[model samples]
Target: MSKMPTPPTLPTATVRPILDMNAYDGQVSAKADQGNDLLMRRTRNVGAASVLFYRDPIEMVSASGCWMTASDGTNYLDFYNNVPSVGHCHPQVVSAMADQAARLNINSRYLHQTTETYLDRLKATFPDHLENVVLTCSGSEANDLALRTAQRGTGARGIIVTECAYHGNTATVTDISPSAFKRGKLPDHVVSVPAPGKLAYGDDIAGGFADAIVKAIAVLSDRGHGIAALIVDSIFSSDGVFSNPRGFLRLAVAVVHRAGGVFIADEVQPGFGRTGDAFWGFLRHDVTPDIVSMGKPMGNGFPMAGIAVRPELLAAFCEDVGYFNTFAASPVAAATGLAVLDVIRDENLLANAMICGKYLREGLQHLADIDGRISDIRGAGLFLGVDLSPNGAPEDANGQLVGDVINAMRRHRVLIGAAGKYGETLKIRPPLCLRQSEVDFFIEALGKSLRECG
Candidate 1:
């Protein structure tokens, strides 16, 4: 056999936990909003686990399209939420949920026409091979189920992921998500490779990424875990949005398959036309995932998620254990999900994402030309990552600079967030129904924010 490519030397930047990046630290920020009544109540309610955005979290009262109205009557252009993929408080989606709830809302165990219809519509979007769909209440549950299914199907405990990936919040999925860990290290059964980016792989991302996977497989086997699955968000959202040189994931996927492991595409971030290039992010890479886990935008914020798997794999897993969810595939969820799909089709949001994404990138490039601190811009469709540095050097990326810019953007009435290992990449994800005028507004706000931060 031909020798496998060697893994490349990676950067030494300290990886930031996904939740900690751009998050409000209660200890430090408490004094700023000390007299705020809502803040006091929230702190008392959720306490230490309350993760709010910004140094001063805005209290949102209402939202529509791509704008959110704060309690103080300030309307901010939303650029950080993907949960409302089609738009915020979409009338059709809300109406569907209400109508179904009024008529009938029952669990998946019951044979409901709306539930089956929604599943049929959803299944038509995937590859023909993924014939089985399992519904859940959240992306975390979907990922949890996917990992369990992969483990059962392959009889291996080992799993592989990108270094800064944020799969979900469940106990099982958290082990595989390096970005979710605030203190402890990943378990031995889980291994992570550097994300597919020029900083790590230089010119040959496909070869370098595949080589890393090979090394990870070797490490897992040596640890007596072997390989169960190689799962990832094809867009690599948390790893600074590495979505370029399409088909880069094909080789890495092949490596996993050769090692007798399944490939799970975590589409929680890049699914439902958010990437624009394809309906699902994996479709852009041209790789066949053994299982595709999705959520977040499934019901356009209605709390529904699921995994589409190969029939054989699902059957193999179900043979040993029974599975069911109390709220999954409910009539209300089905109606809401169906409406989301209809809105996507009717509004031509996919094309809108593609066109608006190009416009947004071009505007960002203009900003990059003027601002040396704008180190790099990466992403597809409405999801994007813009790196910030003290200078023009990407190796010297500055999370502090990003933090200042994010807060400044908020002051300019545009809300955004951070990503990447060092929290140096501005994670920009607006509603899919974004307009050109709104794009212009974001670009203007970003320019001003960069100037202020610089």
Candidate 2:
């Protein structure tokens, strides 16, 4: 037999990596020379596009519940992962995945009762109108398919998204994601609008967003590419976790419909009851979306994602081209999805998120009260953002402060990340199973890091 051909490799820096902190040219760590040597070997083998967290990236070996153990035998409280929504490596999810994989892990082509059961339970969590669902292997595929459906259904090519929004990584979806582009330029068919201002309106948050969409629609219509859909991350997560002014999304949804366009809710980040009050993030806004894309936490870190749509919207797309995925909605995926839902309800994770989230926010608020560098704190449930600044003024926009805090927290054995256009907002989204004690631990670490950075 002929030898298998080796895969071609792309040169370093050819593709800008995610969360690449190349500007920070510093030593990995003074404590662990062995770990730093391993990191050097990893960079050479894993290619330049592999992004790692912290100034001295950790080598995590395993995790369970709200804690992860690094290769250096350090236990770190995980407050940066949302994919393990129910908690990392929960017994229920692990058992389901293992049991199903051992039994039958076939494709969707086969008629399986497990898939039907999982779909039935999944559909029950959503509104009645969002009854049709098409499963995909990843959120990128779901968003890509949703985009195609919107354009075909509305007979238009124009799309509108938040100025710094990121939906996914597919080629087509990337055009609509201004945050993903290093140059920050969107395609002609796509229009970007500023995200809901943090202090825009305490009670009328929907008005500004609606007005922006109205203007975008008019401009796209004038340019001959009529509006197709307006998509947003329900929590406005990347735009700095703007979840205030409940039900503010109603006006935007209405405006999209008025302009003969669809509204798509990208719930890949905020779904699975992470936002505390509801099962889906879009529900908190008191609006119905034409289509909703989900992933990440759906299978509790498994590669399962899907788009739930109104039957009418799905019908139109099906008429043109039907969706099919070999590994999507497979036996193993169905089992994993079912297990996640079971754990969320039986373990009462939503209630835990609400209680612990409030506790965490109050703790953060206390820190903000004493420190001027803590500019603003906002968000819903476990998905919160803490804005950092040197002078504590709104105009500071010091990305370095946020970066320093991240590195400091990592050194303290607490994992976290940052968000927003300038990457100045600390993104605190731990596993939904976070407890009161864990919340206190994180707060202490954060306070210490804040002081050190100051």
Candidate 3:
């Protein structure tokens, strides 16, 4: 008897392992670790330890052409890469990134036209009111500036935010985020109200929005608190307020204005072309936000962010105090952002999202009929969700069924995500460049996973 002969060692960079498993797409088989001993060692204690890691945890080594390839050599059709709004490693974006890095990767202090060009491109996308932009390194930072600008412009100390909505982890935003505020007790300046949920609010979406905004303003004002801003995610991405009937936000915006509070639209999650029909989710509301904060898809995963405030607010902020960020308007980031805009327009991804998103929703509804456990299926455009509960509107999953379903999907090689306070809803936020075929694949995987979970 003899031990099997060892294969000749391949270089660390070139070694590709044939994994014993499949990715979301089986045709693109994936392996956990090929030639890297370190990865295998790390996975022993830390990898494959969670429900989300049911499949072989192959580290993705390369990505391109709307798909990602893992170390095990499996290819995944990336429907959930919103951060890469344009696409995975799009050639245009890659070339721009390389070109900018080689030429001028400097900061804003050096009076460069790159920043102006980038800002102009962004401004052109929004309505006329949101004319001024101040660049930031992230959504959280942009929100921070937005808050400061609003406070300065309106001379208000009170802020209103939606329930369960996440507006970055910054101290200011955390205070306003009721769901996030429980950490150290909510900040005194922050007030919150229920986010209109799909099942709870139904078609008459205006029932609570305006009243809630007005009430929050009154509560703070009664204590001699000035109204600073009514900051909210254009569509509450985390809290499940995908869209209230047309006039919900419009009415809320009016109330905030009447109360002398600024309306800040946090577009971190729903900005760019993710919502499909519109460039920005706030556009769906019909009322213009005094300050619009954008991120996530701005640089297509390059970590660019900004505050597009009303010109008046900009002037007030300028008069109030100086504002600057070290990496704000960095040339490379601006170039990447510019390239993203060009690619989004050239590829007509927004129209694609609109059409594909509707089809996906209809497919999910059909799936719900097949699976009673599916409590609710709601969303706008590419930002969608499938609620797992007996009642279609459970804020939280009563049992482990929803969690189990998500885990099962991963096992089947589909990498969809989950959300809701109890992780009950299966959240589907695929990249904007996603096509109908990919969604069909996801829906099929999802249907099978749901049946298996039960």
Candidate 4:
């Protein structure tokens, strides 16, 4: 038999591969899919990059609201997807897209009323200083542009990111995303700091996190890559949803600004009222970002994203090269985006998120009281993270236990995923239209899943 490779020594809080968390083993999946034609065909189609959830991946045919219907007709309560933030296949958004496509769906090169109207509505949600909006097709493209703009504005090559941050998959952005690194180390220009959490920063999270940024700035300076930007997901979603101590980001952001670095709030995960307390996650910290890259739920899964940037930064970047996306800011995209915004306001989804989020947290806390395995519960609004530990100790958190519980939850017909550096935190992010009954159902399923895992 071939010798098993020795696992590398990891820190107490190690950086786990983002894509591998709660992901199925390819070799095992291949063996399991021996007789399954669909699964085998999928493997043949996508090959090695085919990353599917669960050991036994379900073929989903249709979805609505918070539930996904599998091919076998079983309904799975979706707690994993955040793409359809306003709820899956919302009628208003679908109608807007279809109508616009039928009427006129031209590129941004031509002036369109719907495009400008959508920009006006979207721009109103951001700070006044962020006067320029550059549309893109995905969060990756948005972030790539933000990075280039930051570099151009500051004339620096360095970036600071959270230890396990997953900004995007673009070649340039990937260099700064530690979680995306499967084997190689981060590029020299990009520096990573421990996530701003109680474990890393103790009592004074704000000060400690800022101090780390200062150190990162110095390191980048020493390497001749002066600070360009401190880009982060304000909620720290990939770093395990660390959304406590409200304004903890203020000090860190100030530190970055002092070092001549711009602040880019990568809101691909936390934007569009998902956090409930504020329209954007950065708003909760009261720190104005030089650039804000948003996607995922922007068009409610319609594949539209953009960056809200300070006018000066955009101007500076534009001086050297022009920026335009052929498919972005189209009449169809604008209409779809407008519909999402209208739904958010008309349906009072933000208020619902706050109400439902509080209820969800309370239920999780109640579960924690009964089950000592649940070590901690963190986050705000609808985006929460539950840490699972063996023997009721945070330091002894077990990813294996978390994986088992996730599988158990799947067996109970509730879909969920994992997060955190150790893959020990349950990443719970349902749609904004989550109701009291759905929260109750999730809580009950979780309790049962915990019991089953035990």
Candidate 5:
């Protein structure tokens, strides 16, 4: 990754789980006054699992570039969304999707030129060894397929994941996401390890991660579930955004390979040009994963995701079990994917991310220098985190500061989110096309929010 500016380190406190609306003390009726009745009716009709962000959810009507216009005509600077990697509703992507939909949208069974062209372009973004791809409509499905492929290819059932890691929402994937477990328990076939942290491991972060994976592999094998795959969110977004010491993932990947387990990189958040240095987050670590699952920004908010795998691994799985998705790899999805690539290259968003990200981080670091609560700030490119803690202790503050800061930012019309095991980190991942002026606005808003919250 590019050596962007980094704030000084402090002990990172585990953030709380995602916010629960029921537990929120904010006035629910307030939203109803602001025309949330329709939303509430839809919410009631929708599945109970469907959740909305903010105490008063954003009834977003339109978005452009890095700003979202809410129902009440309030424009919020988007700093928490990566779904629109190129930017919200890019003209090229919208036009491509519309044109492709008007022309033809068909399944992969029938040969399609757009599908072939899209896949070729996507595969070109990956390493030479990762030549095959299986398309899915969502990241959850892609991750599920990658997991199944791992077991089929390696003939092992065990999986290793970082504690508090969230790969996807599927049944099998939920088992590996330690935070998603109902009772803080894991399945027999899965094991959780601490993600690379500054406090627990001290200087040898990579060694610590490698050792944990090795131990997890042994434990899984001894427990009769032989190691099949060790998967991770390359950015460690859920585990408080640990993206320092580039190439740290190589050590753990080597251990996984030695143990006959595939290293699967869940690049849902860090893929595309968000990482600035490279197209994929795994490449930042200089490690080649056997299976790389990507989503979120693939089609620039067009519900497209897929897994790129080594031909040998995918070939063996396909030989025994064929795969197909009804809406995946459709012509419309191909056009959207192609358009996303075009925007990234044509607009030079990667370089923008690098420059803007450095400016943002430096501004954040200046804030940290002035405020003790802004304990640690780390990550690369446009995806970054600001770890907040009380007295700089890891065990303090359940999300009071973070929640205050986030809500305060909302009041300031700058959108951002919280993450980590106490929700103490501000997860600032704006669209890759964010400019220097917008970065300055975000920094100014963040500073004011911090001061007001304090």
Candidate 6:
């Protein structure tokens, strides 16, 4: 057998100043106006115009490489999206889709080898225990399956999840996700725990988060049976991309299992090489889960999601009832997922994500000296977070400051995003193909934005 050959080294290019800064600024203004005009006249969301007052929602016309061109013909740096894992419209994936579509694009019910092959390829990325896989049309569906499977396997109804975790948008998933649905009204059968905040908790994430879960499980067990499972976003992507004490998940999962609950790692955001050090974000903690829900980057912008369960747990789920999604593991979706995996392995994007993430973290940290608004920096690989606390304190009133920074960054031709209940954290989950130049530009833009906001 031959060892896999190494990928060729990355090439560097110079950014020529052919276009003036004013030229770009004028384009951005025109683009904003155009977007506003169209959205106000044409589109509506919840009976409101597409213009959300947070600036005109970008009518992205097309994207390729690391840039997105809006309907107004102005380009913005694509740094806020993690769904385009291999870069926007990566040629390899695009070509694969075109080739496979011409050849065979069928449903899972059809007899095609690609679906099984793609499933096998995906399975190889997981541990041996997580052998059985169930594909779904989206993360919300994957999570819904995960919840149902966990309940059947554990015979428990209580679910413990991160306080700010955003698993998906379906009814069952929304019940588990308090950040979006349970806000202002607490969720039943759910125990929410705070996300890792170093300054607030003295960096003792393992102690704090674990204690919360332990107490909840004990309370639930005392009242009835134990928790059905504990669901969490491995990187807490929506909760400001938290990366902390490496072994925290290991401890938490053990506790949940000891309490007779399934350990579900929701890798919707950090799966597919976004975490770099491991193929899956939870793997970084050296912990295997009873149920692993994957989405977002799995198909690299396609609506493909899945859950890989421990064989025993899956057996329990299978015995309970027959469950199938119409589009789950469809040939086209499977091909898209397989192509994404190929790009990750062939291009060595895992290592790239880690290297580039470190570069971004260091660059952002350096700006803390220039602008104190950037209070905290945390994450692993391309998943990152920037807290807008004045002195790295958790309760600082920089919520509006963070919003101002995001809007200001838009003016600088860099599109980023913010998260956290207070909306005070810059959630920087760029596609794994992000390069150092883009990171540098983000840092400069962010620093300037912070200064201007002050």
Query: lDDT of all the models against the reference?
Result: 0.92, 0.85, 0.73, 0.91, 0.85, 0.76
Clashing pairs in 6: none
Task: Name the regions of candidate 6 deviating beyond 4 angstroms.
Answer: 1-37, 41-53, 182-184, 222-225, 390-392
Per-residue lDDT over 296-324 for candidate 5, one digit per residue giving the tens place of the 0 to 100 score:
99998999999999988888888998799
Candidate 2, which segments miss by more than 4 Å at Cα?
1-18, 21-37, 199-203
Clashing pairs in 2: none
Task: Write candidate 2's Cα lDDT for 230-283 as tens digits.
Answer: 999999888778887788889989999988999999999999999989999999
Badly placed stretches (over 4 Å) of model 1 are: 1-14
TM-score of each: 0.97, 0.92, 0.85, 0.97, 0.93, 0.88
Candidate 5 residue runs with Cα over 4 Å from true position = 1-15, 19-35, 182-184, 395-397
Model 1, C-alpha of 15: deviation from truth (Å): 3.2
Q: What lDDT score is found at residue 131 in candidate 2?
A: 86
Ten residues in a row with the worst lDDT in model 2? 9-18
* Reference-based TM-score, model 5: 0.93
The clash number for model 3 is 8
| lDDT value for model 4 | 0.91
Q: Candidate 4: lDDT of 274?
A: 92
The pairs that clash in candidate 3 are 19-31, 24-413, 28-74, 29-74, 31-72, 79-430, 375-392, 376-392
Model 6 per-residue lDDT tens digits across residues 1-454: 2222323332332111111111123234555656466554544333321223244456778998678897878888877778888989988887777787888776677877889999888888899998899888899999999999999888888898766678887888888776665225545677777776664456677777777789889877776756999988888876667777677777778888888898899988888888789888888888878899988877778888989998887788888795777777877787778888898999899999989989988898788656655667788888887887644445553455666777888888788776675666787877778888888888888877776776
